[model samples]
Target: MIGLVLAAGAGRRLRPYTDTLPKALVPVNGDLSVLDLTLKNFSEIGLTEVAVVVGYRKEAVYARKDELEATYGLKLTLIDNDKAEEWNNAYSLWCARDVLKRGVILANGDTVHPVSVEKTLLAARGDDRRIILALDTVKQLADEEMKVITADGQGVRQITKLMDPAGATGEYIGVTLIEPEAAEELADALKATFERDPDLYYEDGYQELVNRGFQIDVAPIGDVSWVEIDNHDDLAKGREIACLY
Candidate 1:
């Protein structure tokens, strides 16, 4: 499986930092960027090939592509998301659907987490599961977080930011392991999701999969130190915990 990163969104809330750089390029640990950390984690886990979906200020990534490849010792496959500035990540993810044939361990470009998160997901992979998300049950869920609801054997029944926080089992930390078996259906679901509403997130696509009778399971990342950098506050917190990772 290849490492897939969705780094296309234009983080308007991040202003000047994102003005010329994609959110993934925002440095968390000294000179190491969020993308750097992800690549590092993927490398440690022996994924020598990585695909990054880039848009918005994609030139920044292009400029550093060679260097990133050399540093991580991995070949880079850069996928372009033409609608990145206008649409949400449902489209960004769909843009990389072609690469899904090989399967992927997907990481949100803006998330800062340790290699343990990746290791946990890799360890949990099995033939019975097609899509496995890294869920954080320990974190306090808010309306803005992508919350999840699971059943005894039904696996993930719901995944959306609109769900009531009280009923949620945990928050989806934007990391997912998509098996090759799930690729076509996931691509179709994402296509339907984005075609219906450009503003929909990829988590909505997961809901579409559930709606179609497909079970998407969740693996709890038990008390892990991680941050999804959105605004300045998240970036600050990301920097603080990134060094520990």
Candidate 2:
């Protein structure tokens, strides 16, 4: 399966660090960047062909891309989202439409999770649907995280930006294996949402899919060590979790 890494965001939450470099390139642990850790995790999972969508500090991302390809012998496809300043991550996915057609595994570039993602991908068996790895976060999720609300213990009822701490079912772990056709449908919905309001977040498209009775399976990753690097504090937290592996 093709691996699609969304690294196009400006990472405004990261502040001064992001002011100098893309958030994906921020140093983690001793030397590895978040993007490097993500690619290494993918490599461990046997995903070799990778498409990294980059926009903010695109040159830095490209330079790191070169370094990764040289070091890992990884075949890296770099796609630029020129409109990243105006659009959200759904637009980044739209930029990689060609690869998305073959049922690619999608991930955010800043997440530092264990290398067992290969098992998660192998577990995927449904035909032409979106499979989201939903982690049961009984611990309070941060406000910026994307959350999923479920119904009947199976269906994804809604995907929303975490605003209310009370009603959330779990935090979405930023990994999804989506069938090409379902991705296309999501792309169309994303376009429509952007047409209506270009500033609307990608979660709106997911909510639309859930409202239309689309079956997005929630593959539970309960208590699996995962941390998303969004700030300096998050970087420290991710490094701590990375030690578990």
Which prediction has the highest TM-score against the true structure? 1
Please provide, for model 2 over 1-245, each residue's C-alpha lDDT reduced to its tens digit, 9 standing for 90 to 100.
77788888888878877887787877776677777777777777777789999999888877776789876667899999998888777667777878877777778888887766546655754654465654556657767778877776456887877467578788887877777667677777767777777677666767767767777776666568788787778878988876666
What's every prediction's RMSD, in angstroms? 0.7, 2.1
Candidate 2 stretches with Cα past 4 Å from truth are 127-129
Q: What TM-score would you give candidate 1 relative to the actual structure?
A: 0.99
- Backbone clashes in candidate 2 total 0
Worst 10 residues of 2 by lDDT: 127-136
lDDT of each: 0.94, 0.75
* Model 2 pairs in collision: none
Per-residue lDDT tens digits for candidate 1, residues 1-245, read 99999999788888889988999998899999999999999999999999999999999999999999999999999999998989999999999999998999999999999899888899888858999999999998888999999998899998988888999999999999999999999999999999999999999999999999999998899998999999999999999999997
Residue 121 in candidate 1 has what lDDT? 91
Off by over 4 Å in 1: none
